[model samples]
Target: MSIIMQYIFNGIFDIYSIQSNYYFFLTNLQLTIIVTCTLWALCMGYG
Candidate 1:
């Protein structure tokens, strides 16, 4: 029973870590897009 509980806890931790990583990656991607768009606008003499 204890071993099963341990495995469950480990699984939950792994899932949480994966979710955090995915969130971080998405945030970085959004930031990159924004920066790229801003640069493009500046280069085009719009901003």
Candidate 2:
């Protein structure tokens, strides 16, 4: 009853948090890669 509902709610929350963290990490990684590429291009006189 209430315990089962609580467990379900907790599971959903855990999953949501994990998903958000994963997306955050992915965004940071993409930004880092883009910055690195841009710097490399500038160094090579392409920019």
Per-model TM-score versus the true fold: 0.86, 0.90
Residue lDDT tens for model 1, 5-47: 9999999999999999999999999999999989998989963
List candidate 1 stretches off by more than 4 Å: none
Q: Whole-model Cα lDDT per candidate?
A: 0.97, 0.97
Residue pairs with clashing backbones, model 2: none
Error of 2 at 18 (Å): 0.7
Q: What is the lDDT for 39 in model 2?
A: 94
Q: Model 1 — which ten-residue stretch has the worst lDDT?
A: 38-47
> Distance from true position, residue 13, model 1, in Å?
0.5
